[model samples]
Target: MFYFFFESRGNQTDPVVIWLTGGPGCGSELALFYENGPFHITSNLSLSLNDFGWDKVSNIIFVDQPTGTGFSYSSDDRDIRSDEEGVSNDLYSFLQAFFKEHPQFVKNDFFITGESYAGHYIPALASRIHQANQKNEGIHINMKGFAIGNGLTNPAIQYKAYPDYALNAKLIQQADYDMLQQKVSFCEQATKPCGNQSNAKDSCDKAYNVCGEIFNDILAIAGDINYYDIRKQCEGLMCYDFSNVETFLNQDPVKKALGVGDIEYVSCSTTVYQAMSADWMRNLADGIPSLLDLGIKVLVYAGEYDLICNWLGNWRWVDELVWSGQKQYAAAKNGSFMVDGKDFGLQKGFGPLSFLKVYNAGHLVPMDQPKPSLEMISRWTKGLPL
Candidate 1:
């Protein structure tokens, strides 16, 4: 539960947005240094200000959670979390303590935001916060809304988009798509019992394995292409490398600056990933309708180029969401998401929910299209148009 907070450079009263990176096990420092943090790690192993960092418009917190990721750790194995309940509770506790300690920013508008697997994390955590607030939770957080970027929220709906996305992107042939559709059909069947109805670990784990093969099948056809950004090729096993973040964080002077005495920086922990495996196929989107019903704004945005958690999947899930605003949202005309008077993406929304499809970017929207991503968030948190 180690977190880094960066004050807003624009306004002290601006919203506080906490960022969570997704590996199901990745640390948020990856977002801090590489994506939307105040600074970027220079080639000389030093930090340089990032002009497009989100902190320019709002206070930002990048946290490492679930006990085994990043500098956060526990001696007890019981501390390791396997599902959203434990994960959400831990984050709720952290926020309570954080707001209590930093009372200066307590009244400022708060937002939950992250990329990738954070799709799963954000909705669950939001539901937890809303429930706790309803029960007269301590230190009422002025939560305004949350935004997810390239996240995997509804596995059943999202998984079904895999074959169609691959075929539309021309990454696979018609025959390959035909085969993948069968995999999707099997995945849907396997995932049914794991939906909002049950939390059976064995059933969920089986669904996770079965649905995962869809991606493996796509990879088998599309070789060496980065699933994060289909436009690029992986250097090795990773589409993009953050070894430099690891190197810089491990530096003696850097660790001392951060007061992380001798704690090794883990960019991603496989143990945490394995622990959360059975929770993967569970439909996190099931929690969203309630949040939206309470007027908790949700913005689901995705980088169109990503294959792993592609915009197609995100769009489908958001569109298929059964909120009160569902009909209006479906009927809403697609609008241009403009940055500097030019269209950077497409967006659609009604009341408390919105979806944006960012162009010319990948899984990490902020990293691929920095200025526009910053513009998107600045407008979003301020209740301005996207």
Candidate 2:
């Protein structure tokens, strides 16, 4: 039972945007209803309508995928196992089932988008879809492009983006930046030995530790950042609260949005974790390469302010892309551009792909900068000359 949001505008057959939530264990429902949906919360904690939902121009489907997310679950006693291949396969099955249930959408244009660890999910799913298309089997998914915000695609690239993003946000002092850079250099040198190891390198571990230390030092100097406080600023917007998991799970609004019944868990369920761990192990090697080879367009976006999946780490991973003939796109300095009638910013970029950095945004760009995020996505999906 997957939770989804559907919209049909007049006679236009808009693309079906399947939005996947991040966290090899996270729920896409949370991203939709809470993080950046068309609904906001009232001062009394009641729900209100959001005017900027993606439904305005497309049929959006927010799924709690891979089973055990939100309303989606599996009764097969098989131990929950998740990997790039397994997830890709599971998603394919789900799409098959979904199309059967909603046959009218069989030929609708489809696009996949997600955040965080979905960096892995989106690419793998895209690859699977591309493969199925090759065999002329399953529903004809009019897949055009993919998108992610503040994603965890390439661990290496994500790690390196930290200091630069910090500097841009004015969150780090010059002295601190220099210190962090030296530490990064040392971590890079140390990671050389573990380059070929299946397990992540100790150097990479050290690099992450050093980066964490830099963040810690910044907090020490400027006071710790309050994520909840940031959420309060967007008071009416839907947000996640893991405090009382049971109550949160049973909440009517959440239940309705996620299309889940009672007796289900929210946030971290055993099913979700198993699926995530399985996927991690399977894709440890050759996952990204396998996807790129299929001619599927894999795009990753990052919010500069995000610390969890920092731009530095993501960048580190992307730099490892070995696929030939791949191109890169760069964003303008001011980071501002126009799409439709809306003005959005450049965010960021690597080579042919550009990562839009949402100013003042955190790990959840939609929550922090919903309008800009939406605009950026609109342009991306259209493949417009941004």
Off by over 4 Å in 2: 9-12, 41-46, 75-79, 167-223, 226-249, 252-259, 270-298, 311-335, 339-343, 347-352
Those runs of model 1 whose alpha carbons end farther than 4 Å from true positions after fitting are none
Over 1-386, each residue of candidate 1 has an lDDT whose tens digit, in order, gives 89999999998898999998888899999999999999999988888999999999999999998778999888899999999999999999999999988999999999999989999899989988888888988888888899999998999999999999999999999999987888888999999988854458988998999999999999889998999999999775457878899999998998998898889897999999999998889999988898899899999999999999999999999999998989999999999998888999999999989899999999999999999999999998988878
The digit string of per-residue lDDT tens for model 2 on 260-318 reads: 65646666465576445423322222355555555445556665556656655554455
Top candidate (lDDT): 1
Q: lDDT for each of the candidates?
A: 0.91, 0.60
Candidate closest to the true structure, highest TM-score: 1
